[model samples]
Target: MLALIGEALLAYVVIVAVQILINDGLFGLAKVFVQRIRDLPGVDLLIGAVIKREADSFLRQIDSKRSPTVEMSIKIPEKGISHDDLREEMKQLKGEEVNLDDGQIFAYVYTAQNEHYKAMEDAYLAFTDTTGTGTEKGDTDHETLVREFLRAFMHENALNPIVFPALRRFETETAAMAADMLNGDANVVGSLTSGGTESILMAIKTYRDRARSLFPHIKSPEMVAPITIHPAFEKAAHYFDVKIVHVPLDSDFKPNLDKYRQAITSRTILLLASAPQYCHGIVDPIEEIGNIAREKGLPFHVDACFGGFMLPWVEKLGYTVPKFDFRVEAVTSISADIHKYGYGLKGASLILYRNSDIRKYQLFAYSEWPGGLFGSPGMTGSRPGGNIAASWAALRAIGQDGYLRMARRLMEATLALRDGIERIPGLAILGKPEMTAFAIASTDSHLDILALADAMEEKGWRMERQQFPNSLHCTILPHHVTLVDKLLNDLRESAENVRGKKAKGGTAAIYGMVGKIPDKAIVDTFIKQFLSDVYTCKT
Candidate 1:
């Protein structure tokens, strides 16, 4: 009887344990589904309101002592204002309410000088009211000149390069130019993408498709990259259903090549090395990683979106930037943005492959469409030709010598800022930055990096806060050279002001919370809700 009772108790305990485990798993799944449901259009507003309220509350606390407070006025005007009146109002707001011209902001305005600003404004005005038909027969009118140029240069559709001979030529020429800049030969080929994100997406998608084709038995395609690599790769993995293997970086923010190599397997398709990554602005060990990729016969991608234009110029300016381009034997591809450092309009970026054969994989084509066969080289179907014209114009106008001069000035300013930050007692620079972008963090026990950022914001500085290390980040531009000392002074004062203040709220707190959340699904749902809210316009 005693033995039977003991056996019954054990069985009951095992059953209960299994039931508990099952229940917990179901609960987690249900939570994810609920969060996703909340992210839908109608429901997302509630989440957004809550988040905005939280952020606003935090901002108020941070700016309580400041005279001109950071506040949000969400209500629309009762009556529509004239364009001229609105422009005047905006000017007044800037002069009276908020003035970023005090030289505290970073990166957003590359040319803050009056002459450059006026030139850009004029360029914008010249094209603002123009409209055009297709490229042919449109060059005579101002509205159609850009359109005609684009039509003459490339096809309306990027996918059908054969049908659009001009697009093929333009793409080929652009790729060649990029490859030459990177020290590659005729074997190099690439595609023009919308931006850095699309370029990354194409690379990831190509690798994923190629891996599946080659290794039919491997269900999951994996990629290895440093944690500091741009978040776009993570987004790529999410979209394409590939597993990501993120390797940690060294103290200097460079990737550990050995660990990266160890992470690689037969199922691995690509390895990523950023030429001065976004967070701390430290270049990875690209040569070593490229060699590894060659030995393993894997495709290596150098993400030079930030450094691509600048690094080449910096090299010409006599800076010892590491080799991170097609010149490296294993670097099969690269993504470089013209919008950021290239001084072009937004929405222009390029992705280059080692050769046409490899780039062919990025193309999407279908003959069964009712619209007489459909194909696209990159992501977009009908890209605006105006953007292309502007990008081409900016590149030609800047020229090589112009870029080199800008690079020299920017580097000097960056060094000066670095020196000033180092002089501060409680602040420490993150790593040996290889470019103009760098991050600063607090070494003092009581200092909160986010609080410091908030304090700076109160001073009309729009600095970005970075995670992984909790630091204040900046991306310097050519125009920032004149205001570097002013920025340094403000930063020093802000640091001192927020020395003992706890990080309360704002982007810093939100990101800090996001980092702590173990389940990424919930965080993703929250972010989706936030984005949906941003797009939601009340009637």
Candidate 2:
């Protein structure tokens, strides 16, 4: 026993040395090391200690710079705080948040004019049941349907659709509208989800279940997707116990069709393509992949969560967009966010199947529970009806004309931004972005892209930092339409400012190390620790 224990300890030391010595970022040294010693005694503890040391170092650096937070009680208050006092506190707290309204933020919040925001606010509050009103009749006008119908059904629970048929109709109509926009015939059917992640989860779960029923031999079902496919799919795969095989992209940032086709196997249950993938905003060759899926007899899902609400309009505006919806016969399902380009409040997305037969797998039903028979079409029970109503309202109010206008304006801004970036001496846009989202990279090594991002941050611009190749992601929105020229000027100056400097710290240094780290486990551990630390109460 002592000899075996000493052997395990030596193996652990060797594994740690391998991690430190590996120079190639793509080498699988850690994976091999872990595979060999994973079952050894104390190996888990050794790995845990390394993770803790790294996490503690990063957290201390962050903690040292963090501003003092507002005092928060760990326990429930003994007495209710006054509404006015709470509102004042909220206002003060919000004062520290980034001002997205200033058009300096390129990610997270997406907003149009103040009028549209007001409409969403009104629609949301009207359906929140705070006003305490019963059912009331309303006209069929779209805005009226949003305000009056939502007000009438505000007290209704969406979980019991039979009792609240209005919510049922709202959800059905919303799905149908999305289907039609995606070029699905009457055969296409779907359900509303909380957001993109839930939509993706439902799609993945449906396919996994379908595989279980149809191909029981596929005990360990796998999904094949481009590496650039949204992280939501990764989350879904993790949650559903599905292994995902990632295909690398070409120089153009689009998936290599041959590589993608080769990734599929007898165990592969689903093939995923993205309509304008998030990182580089490049749409995969969906038609080609759809054809491949058809030939392979596999289910194909298009994650249009980022572009579904905008691509149709973009195509209508005369830009060449590759076919990516039900129009491609092999596409089994699609997930799109209504809150994004649909101009709705958050918490609304649609997951559509080619037909009801396929969608049935997404539904969950249980009669064994003593709480009575329960059937849910989505992951969540007791979903908010307000989100459904507001989503429908946003789509109805926007119509095709409004969307086309927004699409045109956004595309114009995107092209102008692209042109401006290309004109800059050391900056270049990565990939041919099919939509308003794209990544900016440093063409010259001397100009550190992340350093440029930090300079932009100093100038009050919020940019999303991306890895796998350090770049800055920009998502152009309606609010960004007027800020294009100013943004270009700042970007040009920032690129110049970052010209010969190494990114020593801040987001640059962190993301730089993360991108270069060969063993992704270290990055994963750091990120998990960061997430836990951020949510913790340091007070």
Candidate 3:
């Protein structure tokens, strides 16, 4: 046991070493080893070919194929095109895009109806110049309050409260409203962030800073979390030089509380739980986890980014949602995304702490620069007022009653989809989902899930494909209710079509190639190259 723990500690030191080395912004240095592994004789290229087919076929499945002449020769125009021409070019760029309006794709975009998007779009246009002027000429209309926020380039720097009063109010009131939903009183304090990932990053950073302030000599700080916890935490661990200790989930898809509690060491600074984790949508036993955190005197962060806006209504609508909020005394902080279920515009999330003191760590008020006093909250310097104002507008627009109605409709849809998937002969849900998002695995040996996913895609319904358990993921949005009948029909057809038949291509091929790779480090190598390809442009 001591040896295993020693290994974990040694690995953590390496992580911290890399963090120190990369401090001067040698970000690519991080991917150095992963890329080198890919270049090994029996790495991605050779190993992938041995797994299935020729070099070209395996390369295409991995998306490792380089650009051809046409794409490589593409060049920037000397002069900008007209607005109409630009819009046309962008449309052409999509080639044949999936119809998101018709509920053709799941996972990313969350939409209910056309009017919902229309209202947000109109709200966005209302404040086209979201950071135009710091001084506010207030508009009496409520939505113009959104525009009032949008019209000014507002900085919520407490150092210059005189310049932007409305922005600060927007941030405070937005946090207050979210706090109210989470059963918080006046004591709860938080800041608006770019998105769920930023909210998570801020929470991790705050606790790390807090630990540093409290125990100045503690160099090796670690966080305890479930394996199902989002990748954002790993990113946080990498960025903040903190060691994250992850434990596996049990059969019920919750973290083994015994193992979780046992994993806590002297260096442990924080505990983490997720409200309906992104993968299987199974929420951890946060109340239990928080209790342990309190016993240990550690900061407990509940990542409710996916469920924060949605779960309150889910519980209200008579679903068996667990307690994971400010209501739970030991839940010291929570990260929630307003855009996801709050139906706010994209790029808005909130990280809430129990009080101002705890939240202060996330706030950096530095007089380091020559320009008077420059202090900004979170990672971003000049924050977008539009995200803040739009969030406020969205919460107001969809009041409690309105949200309840939306929640009811989505739950019903989710239930229908879940039932349909279960009824299908070969497919089975990974676990009993407490929320709408879930993954469906193939129980029948003959059925290939990735092949079925390909079939679904062919039927114009693109669902998120998942790994480890090897399942097809689905998150039933309100728009999904309208497409359910078609979805079920296509799903059934796909199951029948792929039963006992091997997948020729699509997701099956990709996973097959990936599953063959013995080391995940090699997989990471491919991913790094893939991400590099994503940003690579020619000419």
Candidates' C-alpha lDDT: 0.72, 0.78, 0.75
Comparing candidate 1 with candidate 2, which one achieves the higher lDDT?
Answer: 2
Stretches of model 2 off by over 4 angstroms after superposition: 1-155
Instruction: Let me know the TM-score candidate 3 reaches against the reference structure.
Output: 0.72
What is the per-residue lDDT of model 1 for residues 98-217, given as tens digits with 9 covering 90 to 100?
223566643222345588766765665456422221111232332233333432322134444433333443455555666677787778777777889999899888888777766778
Residues 268-370, model 3: lDDT tens digits: 9999999988889888998899889889988899999999988988998888988988889999899999877776656789999999779888988767578
CA RMSD per model (angstroms): 21.6, 20.7, 20.9
Prediction 3 global C-alpha lDDT:
0.75
**lDDT (0-100) at residue 35 of candidate 2?**
70
Runs off by more than 4 Å, candidate 3: 1-161
In candidate 3, which residue pairs clash? Answer: 130-150, 131-152, 131-153, 132-153
**Top model by TM-score, which number?**
2
Q: What TM-score against the true fold does each predicted structure earn?
A: 0.70, 0.73, 0.72
* Residue pairs in candidate 2 whose N, alpha carbon or C atoms collide under 3 angstroms: none
Best by lDDT: 2
Tens digits of lDDT, candidate 2, 343-373 = 6655679999999889989999998799788
| Rank ordering of all candidates by TM-score, starting from the highest | 2, 3, 1
Candidates sorted by lDDT, best first = 2, 3, 1
